[model samples]
Target: MSSINTNKKNTITWLLLLLFTVISVYIGEVLELFTTQKSLFIGAVLFIVFLKGQQIIDVFMELKYAPKLWRRLLLGYVILLPIIIGIIYLV
Candidate 1:
């Protein structure tokens, strides 16, 4: 019974995450279409997107329950990825 409930909860969480992601994408696209100049709304939208990304990464990667070594490795990759991309772009 507990396992069944757990499954249901996880399913709901996933569905909510999907819905939020879709809504965020649509909002960002609409904002882009109507706005020519940057605004505060742009910042808000970016923050929401980043928050959603963190949620997805935490859930999908199971980082919340992972070992210390695994968590550190994941963090290292996350930290290095942006730097690597920036260097590549610069080159």
Candidate 2:
């Protein structure tokens, strides 16, 4: 019974991730239609990347139950790298 519940939860999480991906793509397309600022578009895309990365790390990587330091390090890497890239692009 518990296994069935776990499977359902995982399925929901995966679907949510898929929805986020679709939303991200749609957002990118809309941004392109209305904006000519490369930096702004890149920043929005990077923010979506961060959201996806965090979801993958927490759910697929099974890092939600990991030690605090490990989770922090991995999530930090996922977040910081994109911010760095965006900054580099802006500059």
- Best of the candidates, lDDT: 2
Candidate 1 error regions (>4 Å): 38-49, 75-91
TM-score of each: 0.53, 0.84
Reference-based lDDT, each prediction: 0.63, 0.86
> Residue 4 lDDT in model 1?
87
Model 1 — TM-score against the truth?
Answer: 0.53
lDDT of 1 by residue, 1-91 (tens): 3878857756876887788778778877887788764453455455555555555556666675778787667666655665565445445
**Clash number by candidate, in order:** 0, 0
Q: Can you give the lDDT of residue 17 in candidate 1?
A: 77
lDDT of 2 at 81: 98
